[model samples]
Target: MTKNERLFISPLPRYAYWLFLLGILISILLGLLFYRQVSAMVQHQAEAELKRLSASTSDQFQVYLQQTEYGMNQAATEQYIQTAIEKRDAEVLNQLLYGWQQNRNHAELWAILDKDARIISTLRGSSDNHNPLSLNGLALRAMASANPIVSTEIINKEELARVGRNVSDRLENHHLLKQEGVLTQLVIVPVLGKNGQVLGALCGGLVLNDNQELLRSLFGNSQAMHAVYQDKQCIAYFTNDNKVSFPEQISPAMTKSCILDGQACLGQMQSDGDTYVTVSRYIFNAQNQVIGYQVLALPQSQYSQLPAWVANISLLTGFLLAIFSIIVIGNTSRIRQLFDRERQRGQESYYLGMFAQKLQECTDENEVYLLLKKYLSRDLDVIQMEFNIISADDNCMESIRFTENDQVSRVYLNQSKCKPVLTGRINIYNDDRDLHCNQIDTDLIKSHVCIPFLAGGKVAGVVGLGSPQEQYWTPGRIEYLDAYLNLIGPTVTNIRLLKLLQAKAFEDQLTGLKNRHFLDQYLLEQLAIAERYKTTLSLLMADIDRFKLVNDNFGHDAGDLVLKEVAAVIRAAVRESDLVARYGGEEFVLVLPNTSTDEAVSLAERCRQAVNSLQVIHNDYSRIISVTISIGVASYPRDGNSLEALYKLADSALYLAKNQGRNQVRTAQEYLATLQRTGCDD
Candidate 1:
């Protein structure tokens, strides 16, 4: 053959046959190994999922029982129930019961039993169970303990009829509602009179026959079914089909945990030829007491499939392996497509994870805003973006935009200006119906999309993105953008909430002045500055004259208005450098840095005159009330070294100003002069 010529060689048929057989053997061996590995992994994951389900089930029990008990206890304390019970008036009590019965979410029976265990219900309906409610049951326990009690009992047909409660009258749609016997929950909360005597018991009956609604809601799932047991007896059974009975029962160990111990249990069982990993726990009552047993049975789908496949591997070893090879070869391109798609999703998830980490480290919304600009801007080619966030105080909308210099520029706007915020949904602008958010400036960008994020069930902010391209927001980009918002939205909300809380903590609610706590921290800082720099810091202490009389005559509401008005006037007289605080009731304090006692006294005089000139309207009395204030001035490094000493001197001066005459100013020096004039004084 020439150097570039191709050579065609054919092998013998037996040689090809042996090689193919060897390939089949290798494929079969690999398949078994892979099956075992995957089965183990899936089994581990299933166990973990089972444990999680058990925890969720336990939480449901706690919440349900606690809510039921609390509701009954609150009902017992209702004024109507107490009054009717105290008066032995069945008509009024029945009226209340009738109203409660209308809400079918509540227990099957809502009635009141007298102290003698005699049914005092005015309800005309008969109980589904014929067996009478035991006198020594939940009601007796509630009355004897003088507290709410939750207990389970089996009632025969129409048992609650003795109390005038008709069981069949409620939600008769369920064929399973009527049974040979009914499992019922009796919640009893004792009603007490003014003297703390047990007047009656509020009895609630809950039917538990084939009731999957409770567990279904708790699990947020309807695909999987389970059972409830009271030892050997099944109280509730749920399955995919009503014709198929529950395939398992409570194990001996579960019985100990459920019945004897009234605690949770876990084990494995076989049901209808399928293996299940079961989680069992105690069902509780309103008193937070365990009364029954609940179970969660999840099929071991992974384990079940593994054994069957292991058997199939032997049945179709060589022939199936050859077909598998052919199938794998045929699906090579499709598998690659699947892998590429998964790789893209994985990349997106990695970026989102990093974004979430960065968002969590953010201390303020500005940092979060910066992160959005950094991460999302690159992915979406977003030329401009703005966050239309609602202020925590007034639902005020403020737009934050990034400029070319990377500086955050904020513009305040009305909350109603944004469509996404007002409508609580994402507003997409692609010339669709010629609709757009009024807040967006169309001149700045070619296309825009506004996405709203919710926190605490209300829209907290709208993230507006703009680009120089129309129809630019494709489905993929939109979905990715949603994920980005989900990560960053919570960070913005948390920062805003924290800021609101901090403002509320330091600022007074009524007067909008710095509270005592803030003043205390601020005073220490100012004092340190004065001492370190060897500068004078003057403190002005002022009091609203006859403030008590204002409250006593016009009521506290009017007094609040006077205080707010006075605070505003005082705040107007002081410079921004000066710190103003409400120092206890009707007393105001100002800390002025790098100032003389003379300047502080002058400012105090202005504050006093402003207050004297102001008139507050008490609308309730149709009165215009005139107010006056007394002021005293003290300076650091001149009057005293410490805050306490300066405050005492200022307080003494303020007392002197008030005694001398109302609506006047005094200094610590004046106080000393008066002490000398009086003589025999400290």
Candidate 2:
């Protein structure tokens, strides 16, 4: 053949070329299948990782709330705290509150409130340096609940300063005390007298704005975090590079879904010409009410490339194989690796399901932790485990260590050793020399791994595991531990939520006093005791005087303040053995066992006097309003024997007290005598 003809002619026949084309087509199909499989795997892994991150952040946020609540509650129980509050000792109260503030480095404000929910003393921290002593939404919510409550609502310090200016000309120089639109979480605990009456409340706040460290710890440097407050306002936002400014507004639909409906949402959102996977969760108060939303946004460009890169590698491998046409080895090792991964994934799925089921049955945090320990020790073969949970009151990490010998010890982590871990990074120490173990023998532990469990973008706790052999933490083992923590993070969070719900069931969210529900149950029990012991029982019904005027002139906020103040006064006036409850709006019921009509009348007079002396400053209008309450005393046996009869007589006497103008105390007998005297004159 001629040279040109030879170059053009095929070496094989037409049918052979068709066969070769078929083989190439098949190779392309297989390559596409490989790409799809790998991409799906990567996508699943990414989702799991993101969920873990969200769960961790949520856990940390809840821990902060719990710590704050605990701190306030603990302070409320202090003898000196009650004494300082009762004495209205500003210096002593400030001293105690300042010490508390110092103990909680991040606490922005600590204040002692009188039984009337009036701020008697306060200590402001660096977070909100100029935050004035004013009633904020958080304080109101806490006082209303009458229990330790963590607020999800954000308070605008500048707006508060402006409001204060209206109330006090002295606040004019404060210059709006720029809070920079930071969101704050407040914890309030009601202080109770020996009689279980709420004497006052202790409040602590943590400001979250420009809190770069918190954001970094929550999402790492690669992700984005933002906090949305009332009206869908973006109070705080942070990105990995610190360059991306948050949008002026987020998706209102998402916010409504999260805050109003209390549903977590995850979807793709576009911002600044880039797409992001945004996840949002509701921030709830101790009353189980959603107050805000926390959002995490991850740029799609960063993670979307992973699947493309994986597919491109698959295509490249196929191309190389087609060109070489050499018999490719089966790669048994690669097959085994895939099998192992699949097996591990299956195990994780199974264990996660099991853990969720078990956790659902748990009633408290301690039970959840015990379950986690069991799973780690048995299923995961962890030799020793240590958990260091952040303590908000102490502003430090508290450690709980479980050893192989079944010994449990509580201690604190050396700050120097766990600093990095606190920043939400996984810290691995392959050798004992690199590990810091002040409480444990480092020589006995050859390998250590520290993983941080985050809440609200900050380290809430650290999970540490140790092994006696060097290099024991393989990638597979690390993956297992991470998977286990994913389950634990959400489980612990649910446990906390359950407890809050349980508490709310029995609490009165409005007055911070025992609710009518508790009153009925408790009053009946107390009455039974009084009857069994042949003791006297006195009942007092009190109602705020001219509460309608406060509500009409100053608004409901002012009216609420009046109600809380009167409740506190009544509580303070009663004995420890007495029971007090909010009977209805602007009305309270008090039960005094082992007391006569005179004693009840005297107590009612004391409460009436206390309420008359109260000067409540409106939070919003900055108007100083005076409030008073009228009380009616009724004694069991003297005025009907049953609880219903006593309540009826007290109500009748309360009506007379109101009829003879307000702010007076009247007894059932006195009301009857007046009626009889008037009838005879007629």
Candidate 3:
């Protein structure tokens, strides 16, 4: 409540009609006292009738003004309108204004006005000027305040010409216009920017003197004439007969009050020996001061028709309210439905965004397929996903599928059998009998979609999605599936390439065993574990006996074959926990964890015996080649507790084994005992 309402209304007013004079709760109790006062003026019923008509006419004017303001506000907030204004697109702006006028209302002259009141663009209406029109002062208040303005005033001849209406002389033929200036109503509604700045205003004008459209709608068949006044001076008059005289303007003073005090006025007037009743309504500008007034007159003889006219108005009002209520209720339900759809769309967008982010973190080809499987299952009741393994050497593709239970299955098919892969497009199958992919079962899925994904400029995988209802595969869902498939294909390819590069970096190309670099990394980890647990760890260094003679006689290719055979035999002889790597050419090293020196020596002999049974033929199988390996074993924490010490002791053991015989296994303890005995003999 306002301050005045609390002081005068809430404190002391329960049923006091005097509060009506204060305009408190006027929207609810408007015209209440005026209807009560009409009884006192029954003797002069023409005045009361005039008040009824004037009040009705003023209500219509308020409605029209409010509607124009609302329409302009809607235009101001339109996406296309705002874009056009921000871009200075005059052509699109003018077309939009024209369309709005055609669809909404055309009584007002419409123009898009800049901050300075100059025409930015306008719908081609009454004004036919080659140049733009500008409202000199009518729009100034609205633009400055960033609010709507509605006022009625006499526009001078010079201002009308600037606004592209130079028809002052043409109006000399009408008797009322010859003596009085034109009354024009200007409505200015400001357009706001994104940050609440006033970008411009929409200036709409209704030329009251130009036509009888406004007055005809209000008093077309009524026995009345409406005259406009500014500062009590006659300006314009409207009558169905189009023959109102200037003498009607001079015959009345305010009967109750002038509009300057924010009160309605009733006056008596005499023109041509006839008594007329007049009522005036206030017209305000931006500052809320009365700038003009409207005087509606009714002949005293026609006062008897007042009662029937009021009854008709009351009936029409009730019917309109009933229709408006239904429209409001229906619109409320529609708004809820629209909100639900928007919320669902937002959720789908969020999930797709997460899917894109997860794709970046996958480092293995199988991980990429699993990620794809997870995404499909999130939004579908039943889903199917598969990958095509392309073997370029065999020149064939194999379709592999992992079921929900994660059982792997493969089916071989021609590359051209799947439509998506053959045509590089999406295959949409909706029935069981349709030609579908070999990996995706059409019988299981009532609705299915499949698309091929590319890697290295070639089709690498085919993705399929299934749903029970056809509506689930909307255009948006289909597009998302295609986009994600294309996304995962590249990711899987990159992971496979990285795996291949890692294998090449750590594995020996000739012997197919982990290389020396790989051993160095694994040895540190095993040694740390041994030191923590106080367990035995041994290193065995082995050399092929007479390996140089084999390579020198049978070329380097035969040597590589022999080395590969011997490395395989050693790998088969050791435990799974042991690591064997190519130490160098003609030599191999094994790092055995949790093994004693004696256990390592036994493992080395088993490998040596396995190699003794192996034979490699070279040069068209004409010559047979046999080789033996001499193995040396050293235990950690028994040989100086360091990698260098272990390696030095192992090398000395291997030299002793070679000095004794080529095919044998020796421990560092045996070698040290022999060295001490020989020294004592010396």
Give the winner by TM-score.
1
Show how many residue pairs clash in every candidate, following the order shown.
15, 10, 0
Q: Model 3 off-target regions past 4 Å?
A: 1-354, 370-427, 432-445, 474-476, 532-535, 575-577, 637-641, 678-682
lDDT of 2: 0.65
Model 1, residue 525: C-alpha shift (Å): 2.6
Candidate 2 steric clashes: 10
- Tell me model 1's lDDT, rounded to 2 decimals: 0.69
RMSD of each: 13.8, 16.7, 28.0
Q: How much is the lDDT of residue 626 in candidate 3?
A: 93
Give the whole-model CA lDDT for all candidates, comma-separated.
0.69, 0.65, 0.66
- Ordered by TM-score, highest first, the candidates read 1, 2, 3
Write one digit per residue (lDDT tens) for candidate 1, span 35-72.
Answer: 66655655554545555555555544544445456545
Stretches of candidate 2 above 4 Å error? 1-23, 26-30, 124-145, 158-182, 213-233, 243-245, 251-262, 267-276, 283-292, 299-302, 305-682
Candidate 3, 40-158: lDDT as tens digits:
34434444444555765675465555555655665676545655566566776666555545433424456776655666775543323244343436576777787787776666655
Compared to the true structure, candidate 3 yields what TM-score? 0.44
Model 2 lDDT tens row, 214-318: 555444523345544433555556675455555555675443323213356666666667677666776665557665567777766544423344345545444
